[model samples]
Target: MLYKLNLEHILFLDIETVPQRPSFADLDENSQMLWEQKSQYQRKNEITAEDFYERAGIWAEFGKVVCISVGYFTLKDNERNFRVTSFSGEETRLLKQFKQLLQEHFNLAKHLLCAHNGKEFDFPYIARRMVINGMNLPYKLDLFGKKPWDVPHLDTMELWKFGDYKHYTSLKLLAHVLGIPSPKEDMDGSMVKDVYYNENNLDRIVSYCELDVITTAQVFLKLRNEELLGRDEIKKV
Candidate 1:
């Protein structure tokens, strides 16, 4: 029997990134100007440039993904079993591996790729990197032109909106309200760039990515169980 909807085809993924540097002295003038502006703002706020740099780095580093972790889970005889894997080699190699896994094990046309904010962040990031590497994006990501609900993609953050569409709720906050264990209490996305850059540790990055996936999966499960809403409400699949 088929388990939960698209249970066998569900893949939860997350990535970590670090800023690209130009040997300090060779940093471009445009970058220097932007840093100076940020430094002035930091001074007004009583924060150091190092602090601002780390906060601003997530986007710059987003263009330089250092690690991607994907978690696959399926229900077997009423129990859910999950396998978490990390792809942490060069960016090109990791992107290739991700494609290979999708081709070999998943049907892009049928599988549901669930993410926290994938529609806005993860999916586009992966697609752009794949294109840069001359890799063909999987068919499932072809829903760029389709309506949000018409496609198989699901973003938990969007679901949390529940048609209100007011304030944006964070994954950590949702987990707290829903009683799911917070996975990365030890580290937030803000520190990912530093963890990879300063420590040169891929394992820490992998751990952070994996924890995000796990938290996402937990949120999905909560939605599936009807534990996140009122009885008269219909859950969005």
Candidate 2:
């Protein structure tokens, strides 16, 4: 009998976003003043979109996803292999692709979707983008009003809280603690916006997004073994 996890059903995703460009006509006097102050600060500190994403809480409005990367992992022969895919284009196109991928490979009842800070950010961001694109959401993503533990959704950041909510842990920090090699150490999320703007390099954004999914998967494995299994040992299959 095979005891492998159904990798085809698991989706790990991450996104990169940039601020919405404000129109001159749309800006009120107060808004213009605020924009000027923000512009000056951005120039002074050399802040990039990714920096704003991680630190400024701007994804609420100014942010628009420039890239979304997904990784699907499965166990074969007691080892994990991942199939990665990414979309870098308009939000509508990327979201449509994401929806199609979900429909083609995963069944809502059997598969799980995982992320790092998905509950608070990634999931909602994706959901809103889909709606904005006039796309119907997949069944698995319809977790509104569902309890966190009841859904087939796993967020490694939430898991790392370990029942104490006082401190927040980043994916990079969790990966380090779990002995997983940090893929984004050379490039933080803050650099993503500039990379997209200056270099017009979609590949860089995709790579960053994929790295996040990979790191999130690693953290999930660690948390599953430690918190759920109550043991440090994990059988790959």
Candidate 3:
């Protein structure tokens, strides 16, 4: 079934996020209390909410998307090329740009938005952020009354699970196991917060996010028993 689907119909993507504030103290008193409650079980009694604040980006309520990088395959003259692009800058602005891309290009019933763990993370995260930014949910991200099979989103992690709900797979680990090039050469997700807040290197973070998008597309091709994309075939636009 995977091989039968048209690769061009998919828009592969990944997103990078950072906490809304640089530190817990940066948050208002009400926000700090909310953070404490939100992270109680995850941190347990061992770590303070302030200490766990670095991971706030994992929750949409506490984080803002710093970048959303996307890639898609285009076949010309029997040769395939992958075009990649990114939306970055102020959270609201970038989210709007991304929403426009979805509405304009990938809005068809047959089009799909593919990500490594999108259904659980990227897709919902983007939706939640859009709402927070006071934007309408694009058709692709709006899951209100849609039934399971009717939705046009693809999750590579979910595909890898194959009915094993208890299993979890990170994109880096999956790429390694699948014999695709690693996207975490320079840094990993854990380092994103520090890179964005401390180092102030959004370009570096954007590069990292784009790499993940490319790697995701490669992983999808591998899953379908298709040939992997060559570096020359990938163009960042």
Candidate 4:
């Protein structure tokens, strides 16, 4: 199936997110109480809500997306080129840009949104954050009543599972095992919160996110036994 897939129809993507506030104390009183309750099980009496707040980005309700990087294929002169782009800045603004991209270019049934573990993280986070920001759900992101096969989303991690439901693979590890370049040289998801909050470096976060998108596309190509992208073939727009 992967071999027959049209690369141009897949929008490979990755998103970087951070806690909605700089610190747990930054939350309002009622929100603080809700955080305490919502996080109790995950903390497991081992970590306080304050200490665990750094991980709030993993949950859509307690976090905001800072960057979304996406890549798609274009054929020119019979050579495949992958173009990557990103939306960054205020949560609402970046999301609106991303939504517009989907609505304008990738809304068709033939188009799909792909990411590493996106089914579990990137896709739903964007959808939840969109609604939180008072924006309507884009066609690709809305899965309210779609059948399983009808969902226009692809997960590289899910594809790697190959029926082993218990298996899990990080994008970095998958890239390593598959001999694709690693995208985590400078930073990682664990450091995104600090970079955005302390260093105020949206550019760094965006570069990291874009590399993930490129790496995801590379991994997908490898999975389908296609040639990996050459350095010159990846264009950042």
Global lDDT scores for all candidate models = 0.68, 0.66, 0.94, 0.94
* Residues 144-192, model 2: lDDT tens digits: 7877665777677876786787768888888888877665355777776
Ranking according to lDDT, highest score first:
4, 3, 1, 2
Error of 2 at 147 (Å): 4.6
**Tens digits of per-residue lDDT for model 4 on 98-213?**
99999999999999999999999999999999999999999999999999999999999999999899999999999999999764469888999999999999999999999999
Q: Estimate candidate 2's RMSD in Å.
A: 6.8
Instruction: Please write out the lDDT profile of model 3 over residues 1-237, one tens digit for every residue.
Output: 898889889999999999999999999999999999999999969899999999999999999999999999999899999999999979999999999999899999999999999999999999999999899999999988999999999999999999999999998889999999764468889999999999999999999999899999988999998899998999978
Q: Candidate 3, which segments miss by more than 4 Å at Cα? A: none
Candidate 2 Cα misplacement greater than 4 A, ranges: 1-8, 22-57, 77-79, 145-149, 226-237
Candidate 2, residue 202: how far the Cα is off, in Å: 1.2
> Local error of candidate 1 at 124, Å?
1.1
lDDT of 1 by residue, 1-237 (tens): 112577567887887766555223334777756665756644556775444554443443224667877777655676556677878858889888888877787765678788887777777777777876777788766566777666767788877888776758888888889898564356778777667767777787787777777777778878776333222221111
Question: In model 4, where is the ten-residue run with the lowest total lDDT?
Answer: 180-189
Listed in order, each prediction's TM-score against the native is: 0.77, 0.74, 0.98, 0.98
